[model samples]
Target: MAARYLVSPRGGRRAYPDITSALRAAEARGRAALIEIAPGHYEEALTVRGEIRLAAAEGPGSVLVSRPRGAVLDAFGAVSVHGLTLAGRDAAVDIVGCHTGTLTLDRTEIRAHDGVAVHGRPHTSVTLRDSVVLYGRTVFTGSAGLIERCRFTDAANNAIAAIEGARVTVRGSRIEGSRIHGLRVCDAQAEIVGCEVTGTGQAAVVADTRGELAVTECAISATHAEGILFIEQSRGSVDRTTVTDALHGIVTKSGAGPVVRGSVFADCRDTGINVQDAGLGTFENCRVTHARNVAVFSTKGGAPEVRDCLVSGGNVGIAVTEGGRGRFARIGVEDLAGTALRVYDEASAAFEDVRVERCPAGLEARGNGGTTAEVTGAVFRDISLGAVAIDGQSRVTLRNVTAERGVMGFAVSGEAMLQVTDSEVAGVSGGGFAALGSGRLVARNITVTGSEGLGAFGTGSAYVDITDGTFTDCAVAASFDEKAAGRLVDCVVNGTSGVAVRHNGLVDLVSLRTSLPVVRHKEKPAAPPQIVQVLNNPVFNGPVFNGPVHDVQLAWNNGHVVQQQTEGDGTHP
Candidate 1:
């Protein structure tokens, strides 16, 4: 008659365009009818129950359901809620017990309360697209569901909670600003892919008591707690994801350890990635930067395998502390302000084939009592302080290494046993070997060269041995630290200032020389140490061999010592 469809409400009417009347006329017993809702505000809750197509004529903005309390569509089979705004100020749209029917909610607004709770029965399929479910808890406890391209913000509710089910996928969704976890899965087979979760109290993604949660290729950041927290028997692996700006990057606790691989974790207040003792895990090929504590911490009796990682500019790169141990292979630690490698406080760990570069004090073994550490084939360069600092009064053994550019090749300050052999300490700032405190250092075949300080400084070293070694231009002043006792035998300082001194402790003296005069040995050259290396040497000794020694008056005996090595067979001409 007058260009009209039909709208079914609870009551019936005639002669006028009454939705209640249309619904009462179009009912086909157990079957449902299609009623197109008109645009504008419906002040009361439209209760559509069981098998009906309630289509909104206008868009979400034009069709508003201002219901105070009630499920908008409490239906059974083939119920579709499309393009409608269900504004429950303090209530909710409880999608209770929906089974078999594929509910498509497109461009729909489910605001406040708890948005779109799919509960009760299993095998309930829900495909929500292009929707905004805000200020409510978007929970899916049913089996086999998907929420794609939807935005969920539950300020006063638990964000996106999926529990006690299987085969759930939440993809391409933006979830933020929640009270609890932004996206949490408990006892569910949940996979969050390409989703951006941020600004939450807990983690961006939390897997607690969940069954095999796989978070792949997602960006998670800016949380009050940790970025991604896996705890309580949750076995979830985060692969190739970037998590930053959180309290902790990833916290795997409660006897649960996740395989975290190829991820970037940055700007965390605590450890970049922490695998607690309740969990045993593995970290491979991950880069962590700028952390307050350690970049990686394996704590609490948990064993972790860390390999092929680059850890730089932190206190400690990979810390295996508090009963945590690991196998570190081909890992590198560079530019550390403190000790690069630390085996701390009753911790037992091993390093095989590791590279430490430009550390202040290369390797330290202190506070490690009853703790064992073994380093094999380790190489260090540009050690700003000491190549190796032995402390904590423990026994540490290193086999076949090279330490260069530091105060000493080896500096000991603890009571421990060191077996260092077939090593080289070259171009050091001080002695080639310095023993400060109480320790037992047994080194052999150690080549020492270019030492700007003493060849060795011993303070309280008990048993020290240096055999079959070459000391060239080294040990200018032996017996350096008078407070220690040690011995160096069969070692030669062949270059310059070669002499062993004895001041306080037993500093056995080894004497050598760098005093050879040149100009007198040249035949036709009557000048003196001719200054070929420094050709213009008129002011060398206020007595510049100016007494007509020519090249032959090399011995001035001017009450001072001068060195000249011009390589013309000790000639001045």
Candidate 2:
């Protein structure tokens, strides 16, 4: 029959004086043992080689097991401790070796001085339920374990660390005041659900694994460093979590792919979410607020896809740099301190249905060497510097965009290329379109009105081709320098204070209608403007062609007409 050993502080019938005596008596019989301890403190160091169940005869706080120096229990076979307080200097419980050895703790409290509270080695597993660990570490290497409803405080290292192919599941747990990470998994697998980790010196939850780690419905805050870090070829998912008051809310690097869904990151010292160094991430329906730096940052080939996200009150809302590529759709950035969207370096992005409001400069793309951006259905309003700024050999295409109440609209400089279609730029303090320094712009079906400067201004070898456009109430409808080039076809210019077209370079005006004069080629003494081609066009207030006409069959006056010529030298159609 299985032995039942009773232990008490005082001498009694069928009772041993100490717990170690009862445990030794059961081990000698070679049978399963149940050792019930009474309500007092028993100081002992025990190593069990057989199956044993050590339970308190009374409730918790009644049975205290204290070892002044070393570990309290080392079990090589099956061991269970229920409703007992274990106090020691070294590890309170160490489960080692094979043969399916298991250690189970139910309603137990483990207190240690400078060592781990529980250590599980290879082939050993530990299970904790409704337990508390104080002033110690918990490490499981090459082992598997489960922790439920546990609280850990004042850990010297990580409160709970699983490494070297260990698998651990922690549910409804809390860890506080850990010097390092509150929970760390390295080269292993971990699943943390309904956990809260606060006041950690390093990352609250850090997993640098070759396997997977999952965290669900967790709150991590008050970390000295990043709140959560999943890096080094790890794959994971964090869902419905909130992180606050950290240097970085979440950081993913080194080829890690972590999916974060339905999360909120607020009051971060640095970026709310940082993806770097070939890491790929996906964020959906998330919100970031009050970040000191960029809200969403992707750098160094980190390609992130963000959808249905909102960023408010941050520096740069979304920044992609250093060969990074981002695909953002249906995102809104409001009240930003710097540029709402910034793409630089060799990075490229595609944005769809994005809105930026109350920012300094919205949608800035700079190519130090190579950068590109394609934006569709973008709306920018109440900006300080300009709505869209593209420079430095970059190429940007904006389709179905609207810019209102900005300093300037569509500022393209430094050999850049900008193509905008079906867009409107109105109520801008500066020119509606400013293309400078060898830049190229191809715009179609654009409307510009209520600008403080020229509706379209080109200078310094810039090339502009605007077709099917409307310009109203501008300083000048279109102005081009001597080195610039432009072609306006089928456009209507009305209610401008200055001349409709002030051309000093090569200009072609075809099928243009205006209440003001259609074309005025400046006859500068140094560099004269060339009206290259005026085909099938009527002018209302134009000076007659007084200079030497290249094509004598076409004459220009207030009401001009073309005369037919012979086919030998001059011809008119």
Best by TM-score: 2
Write model 1 residue lDDT over 384-453, tens digit each, in one string: 8887777756667777777878776776667766767787778887777666667677777777778887
Instruction: Give me the candidate number with maximum lDDT.
Output: 2
Instruction: TM-score each candidate.
Output: 0.76, 0.86
Model 2 accuracy (lDDT, Cα): 0.85
The global C-alpha lDDT for each of the candidates, from Candidate 1 onward, is 0.67, 0.85
RMSD of each: 13.7, 10.5
Model 2 Cα lDDT, one tens digit per residue, 1-573: 557999998979999999888878988898898888999988887676678988989877788887777778787688888899988875434422122589888898888767778887877898989998888878878898899999999898899988999999999999999999998989988999999999999999988956578989999999999988888988889899999998899988888888999999998999998989987889999999989999999999998899999999979899999998899999999998899999999998899999999999999999865699999999998998899989999999999999999888898999899999999899987878878999999999999988878788889999999999899988788888868888999998988366688887487888888877655564543322244434435664433555766423333432554333344346631
Name model 1 segments beyond 4 Å from true: 1-36, 43-55, 89-102, 114-121, 336-339, 421-423, 431-434, 444-449, 454-457, 465-472, 476-494, 500-573
